[model samples]
Target chain A: MAATMNDVAQRAGVSVKTVSNVVNGYPHIRETTRARVLAAIEELDYQLNVAARNLRTGRTGIIALAVPELSLPYFAELADSVIQAADAQGLTVLIEQTGSRRERELEVLSGARRHLTDGLLFSPLALGDGDEQLLDVDFPMVLLGERLFPDTVDHVTMQNVEGARAATEHLLGLGRRRVAVVGVHPGEVVGSAGLRLTGYRQALEAAGVPWDESLLGEAGLWHRSTGASAMAHLLDSGAAPDAVFAMNDAMALGVLHELQVRGIRVPDDVAVIGFDAVDEGEYSNPSLTTVDPGREQIAETAVRLLVEQIADKRGTHRPRRVYADFRILERRSTLPA
Target chain B: MAATMNDVAQRAGVSVKTVSNVVNGYPHIRETTRARVLAAIEELDYQLNVAARNLRTGRTGIIALAVPELSLPYFAELADSVIQAADAQGLTVLIEQTGSRRERELEVLSGARRHLTDGLLFSPLALGDGDEQLLDVDFPMVLLGERLFPDTVDHVTMQNVEGARAATEHLLGLGRRRVAVVGVHPGEVVGSAGLRLTGYRQALEAAGVPWDESLLGEAGLWHRSTGASAMAHLLDSGAAPDAVFAMNDAMALGVLHELQVRGIRVPDDVAVIGFDAVDEGEYSNPSLTTVDPGREQIAETAVRLLVEQIADKRGTHRPRRVYADFRILERRSTLPA
Candidate 1:
């Protein structure tokens, strides 16, 4: 059997309460007593039974990551980065594949396993502005995304507007007008795609280029196949955009594939740019010019913030919004340079 | 606040002890009492506190998937498959990245979370025959991979030997006598590579072809870079192998890249085959001929066995050594169909 607190206490010539106090970092334990308990614990290689301790302290060194889907490389990459960050902090992640379900998100939040995790890092796809009640959850949580804008909870977001703006500006600076936006969320104006759409419009307005509704290609799923189909639609309309801005790298890759298939020269007939610098973007046929959303940094920051909040009382820390930087990662698909 | 057991008991018009007995699924409880307790639970949406339940029943529906690394696509895919299988059975996974460190793997097994999981699915890379004590852990676990052969534990493995034999046989059937093996591990005769290496040797012996150690390429890592370097080493040795069999797809991709760099046509110049049908293999330039080790089947089988063992203590179930079927996926990189 594994060594127990009673065993350690007996070995150290101390009471079980004294050993518990030392383990919990209580202030009253004498230095000698603490040392004796520590030595006994070390000698036995005692691992505090988190299951038992969680009953009293109500904390498990586990966290949940609710993401849209892992089949998509972007979310997969983000999950990887987040897991790495969590590993560095000596925590484990319970990944929940939401499959873009709002009900599932709520279910996961209220599951009995919530007691098994210190906090949750939720990335919502279906939950929107009206779901502010999620912020009122008593457990420690860090929100991640552009979909929901509750003011009471901590959120880690990227500069989607600015990043999309830079992507569009990059295409326009190359003297390409009539740019088509791929993977748009219909009607919504705050999600990742919606914000990028706004940034696209802003860029066109700044460049004295009219934002044509015809140039917007609606894609419910930001996948490579969708990007390809959207590009096919845009090309079939004969309203040839001088460039294309795919909201994500997967879609951008699809667009590139479609262009290559139809004998259309990239950067000659149409320049292309994408967002969320995926690793696959670096290995595409001609490579892809995209925006780096600072995924790695955001992951690390979110973990650090959630860990801090988890280690404190509910009202002890003020909720703060952290916005990571976005940069234009210029590659082969945009201009000749 | 969440509804309490007292509230549930009052709502069901039963004693709290009776309610507890019903909630805990006491075999002696009447059907009417059980129905009322369940109805009350549903009405209140009262999810049981798993932490408390764990202390009473000593079973947590969580399992740990201790993998070598997630940065590798293979591990990531394996994790995804494992989670899917586990979720279907109403279980959650707590992922731990061991980075192939034996200490980390053993630490995770012996950690406090051992009480938090129903069992463990351990994939050890560094822990060899010497770490046999792991099989002695006082908990239920299903081992994955060929790193261990302890008769005391249940092991779910792929047809590495037979699959490698088939792959080498496929290359030889293509009239290629000189087949080089990439990612040859050192002093190992029990892991995947070791088993596959044995298969390769068996195939050579059966074919009346001499086994040449000179064609062996050492790759410490089963990654693309390692594959590429190993292929280069083969080329630099002045003996040009007619075919190459990479132990895994990542290494196979690297070999393909090296061939491309050297203007050597795949299949035409040298037939290439890989093991572990990673998704990327299907999309490679010439595509890739690899062995499908039935990863999905392996995952599902392991999960079913674990959940069965958890639900029933007739625990006298025989320890199973399941070797999944392997198939040679014919792609353009191999001999013409």
Candidate 2:
């Protein structure tokens, strides 16, 4: 049989609670005591049965990150950052892909799987305002992405409106007019697409450029294929805008590919800008100009908030909302020189 | 109090074993009994404590997938496929990123965290022959990627050598000589880079072409930046080849970006091909020609094998090896017209 906490405590001549404090990384343990406990554990080759400990203490040292999909570069990069941040906190992340389905999102919230992890970081793409009450669960959860529910859960989100406005202003500042927007979800007022479209309108109004409904290209999903189809629709309809701002880098890439297929020179015929400064954007054909929404910061903040909630066994802490700063990353796509 | 198996059994007018079978998703249970037990469970809102169930039966209904990183498009896509495959089996996946570190890989093998999941699908990049013995663990683990260990764990891998050879042959068949290979790891004999390099050499020899040492561009990591730097080194050293074969799609993208920066027209000045037919390859400037190594099939096969191992509680099954088929995807990068 493997050595237990009692064995380690006896070997180190310390109390079982002390040994547990060291094992659980309870931060306040003394250096010499921690060293002695560690030495005893090493001497006995004691492997803590995480499942049993979790059953006893209700802390698994694992957090679940529920995202729409990892195949999407945005979520993949976000997951990477979250994992790195969680690792720094001596925690591991269990990824749950909801497939952007409302039922799956709801299932993730109320499923028995919640008992397996201490906290959840949820980024829902499909669940809307109607499901806001679903966030009122017993577990600790930090909401991510553009979806917002007031006074319900802790939220770490990007400045979607400000970032999109900045991206449009950057394109307009480059002496380009008649800016077209790709990835606009018509009638959406709260989601990412709608919020970003509002920002685009704000930038256009600030620059004294009238908002043309024909310049708004609709996309159901913020994917590359959707971006390509939107760009195709704009070009085929002869609503040729001098500038185009895609909702995200994935869509921007599609727009670039479609433009290239049409032999249109970027920054020469039509300048392009995107949101989400994904790694692939740096290596894209024209090296995509995009908005850095401080994804790493958002990830770190969200993990920190979730960890705090998990640690707060009393459940007295109030929900908080934090927004990551955003900046425009100027690249070859918008700048010729 | 929440409903226990006994409570569910009593409420459903069935035996405890029948309720257990229904709750465990046993296929042999009668439809009427299943409905009664499910109805009782819903009436009581009984949430099965996964931690307690895991402690009792030693089954967490969770499988872990340990990969190098998800930020890499290849692994991200593989993870997506794995999740889909696992979901079909009514199992959830917990992802662990090893960051391709040997110590971390070893930690994952021996860590107490192993008890938290039913099985593991490991894809180690840094571990090699010296660590093959580590595969002799008590838990069920299925190995993925090019890292192979004989007579040990079950492996589901892509045809690295054959795929690379076909990629090279495709480039050669395009009437191109002096093919420069990018993303070669010097002194590697067993990993993906070395095996792919061997295939490149075999293709050159088969085509009556001599192996040129200068044509090999060494990269420690198979990333886009490495590919770009390797391309730049080849261009600066005046060892310009008519064709370039990147070990993976990420590096191929880098090669394309670098080639474009040098004002070099693809297929006219230089033809390019890459391995791993990732989604991004289709949207690249010239639409990357690549070797599709059957990644989705590998994921599905690996998950199925892992599930089988998990179901074989008696430890009666022997280790097996499986390889997915590979094919070359022809695109505009290799054929200008």
Candidate 3:
């Protein structure tokens, strides 16, 4: 039978609560008493009850990372980065998929698992406008992707608008007019899609290029199939585009496939660029050029801020907002002929 | 201040232990006593301390799903399936990436997080030969992928060998005599790569086709970059093949991309087929004909098995091995000209 706290306490000639305090790494215990307790625990082979320690210290050494879904390559890669970053901090990650749904995101915020993890690194896609109050959670949390929450929460985000502007400017500098854009969320003025769209418009405005409404492809899900259908719709409507800027790599890959099926040559008949420098983009047919949104830095910074919050037991640490750097990764898709 | 167990107990005219029992959902508590405790808790709006309840009941209501890496589309999709399946059982899933490294895989078995989660759904990519003893962990665990552990542990695996045989046979049925196989691990006889190789050989034997040594393409990591390089090596070596059977879809997509870059027409020159019906396969150029390894069934079955072990406090449940079904999904990549 495994030795319990009572056995360790009896062996160490101390009270059970004293033994628990020592096991939970309480700072008030004397060095000699701690050494005695540790010797007793080693002698009796006492396996500390993690639940009991967590109950006393309120530290689970685990964190939750909530994303839309893992099936999307960008999210999968982001999850990969977050997991690695959390691992470096000696933290375990619990992943929750919101499926980009409003109800699921709400459930994540108020879920029973809140007590199971020490903090959460949330990247919400659907919670916006009226859902600001939901971010007023008492638990230690750090938001990722964009700052859509109250100022009291720490956040780590990317320069979505600037990245999109650079992508559009790259296409415009290549002497291509009629720069089409994929993935517009209609009236959304926040979030990734909206900010990236604004960036595209800014680039077009700076270049004195007319904003052709026909070139704007509307894709709700930003999925590959949707991107393909959106491209097909634009082409079937007799809209000729010399270049396209997909909002993400997944959608860009789909757009590339659609153009290939229609017997159009990339970088000749049409140039393409995508956002989110996902690994899949590096191996795509012509390879994809995309925006490097400093994902690793975002993940590391988010975990660091969340750890800081978790460690601030008295709620003394002020919330911080950080934006990771961004750059354009030029590749074959947008290269000169 | 929030109400504690003592407050609830005093209000219900019972011992603090009785309130703890009721809150932990102990089965032996009398209906009247349970109702009184519940009423007191509701009247005081007491939030049950999950940690305290967990210490008493020894259940965390969270299971861990450990895989190699989410950057791989197969594992990402598998994690998604496992999360959904675990959610159906009202269980939270914690994801751990092992990176297919031996030390990390071993660490997962003996990690401190073992006590924090109810059980583990482990898919080890690195623990081969001489590492079987690590699976003898005290906690409840359900193994995924091929069985590499003792018979004392429950296992849920896919039909690797049979699926590969079907994939190879499909290419043979297309009148392609030189059906090259990609992603081969030399001298391997077990695991996914080895089993799939055996199936390929079996298909070739049944078809009475001569085994061409030059037609085998070797790839170590089964990644897109490696797949593309393997295809380039095979093509550069002057091994003219009429058809190619990639071991997985990621590599298959790479092969298609490489062919496209070389201006070689797919299906017109060399038909290609892949295994693992990932969603990306549906959007790749010419799409992809691959094997669907019943990933959802594997995930659901694994979670069910793990939950059973977790619920069986007496350890009375015998370990069982389950194999998910597989089938060939025909797509545009393997269409007849």
Candidate 4:
């Protein structure tokens, strides 16, 4: 018979949970306790096979992450961090792409297919306010990103509003009273764009500057091309603000590309800033000054929370929302006072 | 009463293997035979509740891909394509990260975790010559990438050697005799760097140019930082090569950035090229000239092969080696003489 975690725990006079914690490399556990657990395992010659142990817990030792796509480096890096977190917990990750379509997102929730995996980390893109029914899903799910649905579920979001406010205020502090906002959707009250837009408005009002509708460049999809085209539209309309703030880094890149193409020097002619501390943002032509939303932290927290839920299958914890921090990284794109 | 595959085969006057082939989507099968099998399945309403159908097949309706890491855009996008291709064939993919470690790569092939999936698509980074025994494991497996181990398994490889030859020859054709190579090891005999170096030598010989060992810059890890560091080293050594070829696009981007930092213009001062057709490569400052090794074809072929192995328990016609095509994408990074 194979030696089990219980055998090691018994030999060491410690609980089975302590052995598990040691094997998992939990950050909070004491080094002495971990040493003791390792010694006991050596004495017992116990092999801590995660798959075998998880089988007893009725888990496949696997977790699934359903995201819009990995073609976008933002989601790609996020998935990488999530996989790292899961791997530390001895859980393998299975990724599924739903194309951000609401129907497809809902199908993954339905769990009609094989449920060999323990839970899902979902990031829904094309889902909208009307799809609130998906919130009542029974399976363990951790929703990522800033799209708040009507139904209740565990969600992880960035400090979009606060971050956006900082971005706008930075331009204002640079004495750019007339600042252009890229990647905006008018009259919207939720989502990352809407929340960031509200923050932008709050910043302008707080700074005693009037909000001009002409300075609000609405780019329907928050992509690089949209940013470039919207910047072109803003420049063509003669609403030349002193500075610009794009809601996301990709848009910021598009804006930077457009400015460079039109022979306009960044910061000197038009200061530019973006949201999301994307790696590409750091290496952009002028190195964009942007908001660094804590993407990795959110990914790690979501995985830990899911593992907790999986461990305590019947435990009742109210569905909670976690908001990660955001910081402004001032690089070359933005003008300094 | 539930009907079995054998019953369907008997009723349709076909061999059991033929019935299995029809069910698994073998491309070589005749259309009429497929129709006859479909007719039998319809007569029985053979629902594809693969979840319940294969309790006895001892195979999970899942395929696993073990990659070194997803932090690299090449691996990330490769995993994405693999997942999409798997989905098209009505299969799910479980991705395991090896962190490019030898131990983790071997752990993934242990075959003890049998209940989770039916087949595996493995991409090993650190597995050396001694680990060739892994190829003989008793499971449905498909190896991917440029690393060629002892041959006892189904393998899919990108055109690393030939693609490198073409890239080197292209640069040489532009009258660049003294060329530098980034993301290379001094004497690596295994994996991509070694194979591509061989191809580079072949191109140099074919062009009647002597291979200068000084031209090979050391990049232990083919990452962006390594590329930047390698370029810096090359420049500081006062041996300015006319052109540079980095192994992959991300590292190439790093080279491009370093060149810009030193006030060296691209395609004019020193032309540069890279492999891997990443989206960012297309949108780089001057765009990137690189090889588009058939990533999509690899995904489709791997998934199709894995699905066949899963549906065929007897393991007939197990594809040994699958080679995909490679194409050169002409962009602003490389210019013609």
Each prediction's DockQ against the real complex: 0.40, 0.78, 0.67, 0.27
Model 2: residues with Cα > 4 Å off, grouped in runs: A1-40, B1-22, B25-39
Q: Which stretches of candidate 4 lie over 4 Å from their true place?
A: A1-58, A236-238, A335-337, B1-55, B316-319
**Model 2 lDDT tens row, B111-184:** 45667788999998988867778889888899997866777789998888888989999889978888999999
Per-model interface RMSD values are 2.8, 0.9, 1.5, 4.2
Q: Enumerate the chain B TM-scores of all models.
A: 0.91, 0.93, 0.91, 0.83
TM-scores, all candidates, are 0.87, 0.94, 0.92, 0.82
Q: By lDDT, is 2 or 3 better?
A: 2
Predicted candidate 1 versus true structure: per-residue lDDT over A135-186, tens digit per residue = 6777888988566486688899989898998899999999888899999888
Question: Which one wins on lDDT?
Answer: 2
Q: Give each model's whole-structure lDDT.
A: 0.83, 0.90, 0.89, 0.81
Expressed as tens digits, the lDDT of each residue in A41-134 for candidate 3 is 9998677777877887777888999999999998899999999999999888989999999899888887456667899999999888777788
lDDT, candidate 4, A1-337, per-residue tens: 4478899988877898888888878777777878888998888767655344443554566788988877767788888899999988978788888876778887788765434668888888777666788667666788888888653778888988899999999999898988999988776777777899988999999999998999999987777789889999999999988899999887888888788768788788899999888787766667789998998998999998888777767858678889998899999888473
Docking class of 1: acceptable
Count of clashes, each model? 0, 0, 0, 0
Per-residue lDDT over B153-245 for candidate 3, one digit per residue giving the tens place of the 0 to 100 score: 899988888888999999999998999999998977667888998899999999999999999999988899778888999999999988999
lDDT string for model 1 (B1-337, tens) is 5676888899999987887887767899888888988899899977666777676677778998888876566777787889889999889988887878778877876755777788888787877776677666666778886564767777888888899999999999999999999989977888888989989999999999998988898898787778988999899997699899999988888888788668787888899999988765655556689999998888888888777767666567667788888799998789563
Supply fnat for every model shown: 0.34, 0.79, 0.76, 0.34
lDDT tens readout by residue for model 4, B128-243:
67778776876788889888876678888888889999999888888898888888876677789888887788899999998887788789777777888899999999878889
In order, the first chain's TM-score in every candidate is 0.91, 0.92, 0.91, 0.82
